[model samples]
Target chain A: MDDFVYLKNVVTLELNQEKCNGCGMCLKVCPHEVFGLKGGRAHILNRDNCMECGACSLNCPMQAIFVKSGVGCAAGILNGILNNTEPSCGCSGNQSACC
Target chain B: MTTFKNPEKAHSPYILDFVPTPAGEVPRVTGKLKLRDVLGTFMVRWSVNRDNYRVSPGLYAIGDPTDSSDVFVTANYKLSFDHLRKSIDGLNAWILVLDTSGINVWCAAGKGTFGTKELVNRIRMCRLEDVISHRRIIVPQLGAVGISAYQVRDRTTPAATATLTAGSAGSTKPLKLSFNGLKVSGGFNVVFGPVKAEDIKAFIRNNYHATREMRRVTFTFSERARLIPVDFVYGKYKLLIAFALFFVLSGLTRKGVSFQLALEEGPYAVLNILMAYVAGIVITPMALPYLPGRSFAFKGFVSGTVAFVLTLLINFPGLNFPEMFAWFLIMCSISSFTAMNFTGSSTYTSLSGVKKEMKVAIPIQLISTIAGLVFFIIGRLF
Candidate 1:
């Protein structure tokens, strides 16, 4: 995962240090080690590695983390454009297998 | 061929038996995978009956379990359920399954089918408090995106606060917990488990601690390779249309649309289309990391360029300059577009990154394809 990183400075992930209660929930739930504990608060260690999954923001008790997360699939985007809706991997109401 | 002892659910080959519980009869499952399960997995990998592949959503018993046995939560997708059951084989536990419309945990979670609402609903519907003594449920880490731990905790009222029935002094009546638009009964602690089900044993053995490695998601060669069959099959109809269009287009000549010329050159055009398909759908994914650029389209272009040159070398005597150049544009665009689509399958790509890539890549591909077709017609007709 260290060797494989996506585009840099593109993720929407932002942390509000003032609002953070040093709960460490972000560090515990992130699939990628995007969050690290620094001085008893959650810090974005690897911003580029963040896939915008929104796990950290959802679990954060103090609402310190904010990220506009959605399916990153190009097909999902194209689907959204075609259907005039938010991007989805055709996971809803479609029988086709999706990633 | 069948291991299940339940005569009522005779169609279900996987269920071992149904054990009567306080709420209802829960299906008992085994950890050992049968040949049928393996074949089903193979079919699923190939995406055959993929949409219909699912297990019934409800509570299941893995082994003989007491009231305090650890409860593991999972999706209704048979693959996810199977993996979870197999991972914790031989362990006595209760499995609370939520309906995810046959999708695996990570994908289903991302779509919100495996979210907090469904979890709360399932917990209430299954009367989990009447079966399990402990108030903790282990959920996979990948599913954390949709499941808000705090929301689940806050939504479910603690079992201690549940009202005791007046008529039931020592009666076996389950707790009468009602759910409105907001709250439900028997709040459970959401313990985020490892990303993969295989690590459940180690995770439980180590006192529910997941090492950093267990949380990280990886796209190894095998993992990437498994996704190929579905994607490869995806281009079949498009490839057939391309083949037909190119074959008819090959008949265009200076004098008129010539059928003899089509017979001579049509197969070559089809071969080129096949080359581009292999380059984009197969070669690009295989050589993803080794390919020169981070952009999937760039990698596909590189692979297509190589395939284009290879096609040139293979058909040198028959091909003229205009047709060769036409194919060069067509092959590169096709490969590039196909590779760009791979962003969907890739684990590391972000929505913002993909949006950025597509904005630049789509116009280029569209222009290249149109220009290539024009050049091809010019080469044939003029």
Candidate 2:
């Protein structure tokens, strides 16, 4: 029987294989098991599981990765849209009033 | 459809028919509740027990509210509901909740879920005109994005005042006109204040894996190596090429430059590489605040020069003209490259600023490195 995988299809992660230098750093750091090594190169086996954390891009030695990194919370996105700024979840700030 | 037994029936007796006095309001004991309890209720409202969403988005009365008690506005998200109830010190206040799809005021406002149409619809649904005689409603500042004050006034006769909106309307506006006046509005305000710093710190701590885990540190017999190549990968490769060129030039000047000679000369080669790396990676980030100049490139130059001087004092012992010139070139190159990395980290620097810095800095660094290589060849030959 094939192993079952729980996928969260909220975000997508893409890898430019031609730019990958086969540094297994992405595999070592991703909290989600999204990438698999195929023929000595890193292949993104599970794109939907990615949270768009930008970990792969930051760690890629060859500068071959990119992602739209942002919080998934609607509150933060609303603030960003209203203020014409990058959206951020208010969870990081003063907690006196925010739930 | 079955008549949804109004949850309001439980608190019906306490519901006040008029606006409460703002002063001498008894502080409610809602603040002492545990965060988990509040979050659990919110999760339930958002997920499994969905009636919290169906609670006829309108005004509510949480506790026994008197005519002279305070009135607060909020969303129906149980977490939001709990936050408002808990914040009051001892105030018997009317609670007006708008339907926001389980989202908070700031976000709901931004998405237009908490705008004039919803507020009007909710007020009408709850028969707010019969429950309270007051024409005022308080809103949070964060929700300003979603609501247009002008539009709300046009749609509903009730006056809407934001907690933080700049107004000289005196106290006569039907709404007491402060974000803090309403429990839900105040929640939005508090989240954007001092609590923001703690949130940022937590975010940084949690995301360290994203920031630092990409790079690895390797240790060699003579030196430590950082395996995580910096953003500008080409710079490191170029430094290696420059060193190779220096060695080739050294060989051309002499009959044969053996591996032993290269090893004996390893310190200089390493020093050049170390300077570039330090300026690019370590010094650029760590010394960002103390760098003498504002321009990131200039700061890198200063750091590179310092590193160069320190290396000369340790390695050359007695600095001659050739060594001093070569050292100068090496420092300049290392600093320029490191300074270029600033564009990646800063919030203020623009893309054009980075382009300009690179256009000027890269050529200077390259020319200096080449000049230093020429000097090294001349010194070895003569």
Candidate 3:
């Protein structure tokens, strides 16, 4: 996992320090271990490692985390641009198995 | 009345038997995969019969689950269902399969199919309360994107004035119940399981606890390799069109474009495109870790250059310098674009990151391709 790194400083994940109560929910749901508890607040441990999966933000009880999360797939983004819709895995009809 | 579809006939070979429950007859499944199941996985890997690769969605019993047995929820994709069952072998459990339209859990969760609404609806439809005394359901960790744990634990639906249908197959008659003024919860708590099905047993053995390692997703060599077949099959029609277009373009000569010239130069042009395709779709994914650049587009460019150089040195088609350069441009652009698309199949990548990378890469690829075509025609005319 350490060796397989994508782009750096491009993640949109942001956590509000004031709202975080150090519940540790973000740390649990994040697949990339992007958050860490410091003192009594949740902090970004590794921003570059964040894949913006939305699990952390969705699970956070205090609504402290915010990220424009979606599938990081180039094909999905391209499909969205071409079709004039939100980014999707292009699993509409007939063509399947994008992810 | 809709005809009652037999579960055995609908989901043949997978259903071992049906166990009668208070709700209805729940199809019984086995953890041990049969020969056909193995073959089915192999066929899916190669994109054969892939669209129809799904199991019927409903409640299933494994190892004679009782009222106190843990109810594990999973996607309707046969692979997801199979993995869940196989991982919990020798354990008595109930499986609640959601209709993810044959997609795996994580992907379906991302798309909102393996979602909170679906989970709640399935639970009510299956009459899980009658079958199990416990008020807990275990979901995969990846499915957390679509399922809010607090919501599942607290959100209550108005269970009034709505007809509750039990089975999709019409085997069970529609039951009407009036629990007036009672706001009904999903009737269960959601506990997210480990990210991988292989860890389900360990998590269960440890009293339903998942370690940090189990929660993290990794893209190992085998994982990346498994995705190659599907990625390779993507946009194949576009590849064929590129071949057809290039095959005709190669026919351009000093006199005029003709089939004779195409016959002479077409093989070389087609071969170059094929090599580029292989480098991008196959070699790029397999050799991902070893590749030099962070950007998939850059990594693909490097691979394409190596391939182009090898072909030029060993199997030169005796073309002019301009024609060769044109092929180089074409190969790299094709490889770069295709490899960039691999970000979708990859385990870790952010939407912002891909969007940024594509903003730069797509324009360069387009310009290079157009320039290559111009150079190729100019060389042919001269």
lDDT of each: 0.84, 0.50, 0.83
Name the candidate, 1 or 2, with the larger DockQ value. Answer: 1
- Fill in the DockQ of model 2: 0.01
In order of TM-score, best first, we have 1, 3, 2
Candidate 2's residue-wise lDDT over A1-90, tens digit each?
012111134354568899887866566545345677888789887665554544455456665666665443323444556789875544
Q: Summarize candidate 3's per-residue lDDT along B36-81 as a digit string, tens digits.
A: 8888898888778777677777788899899888999999888888
lDDT per residue for candidate 2 within B285-359, as digits (tens), equals 466556665456677788788887777767775445775677678766766665555433232232333444555
TM-score of each: 0.91, 0.35, 0.91
Instruction: For each of the candidates, give the backbone clash count.
Output: 0, 22, 0
Categorize the docking of model 3: medium
- Return the DockQ of model 3: 0.64
Give me the runs in candidate 1 sitting further than 4 Å from their true place.
A92-97, B1-11, B159-186
Off by over 4 Å in 3: B1-11, B156-187
TM-score of chain B of 1: 0.89
lDDT by residue (tens digit), candidate 1, B1-382? 1122344444577778888888877878898888988899888877687887787777888899777788899997888888998899999998988889888898899999999999998888888878876678999998898999988876776544444542657653335444433233456789999999999999998899999999898888888888888778766788999999999899888887789988888999999999998899889888888998877888899999999999999898877778888999999999988887787788888888888888988899899999999999988865
True contacts kept of 1: 0.70
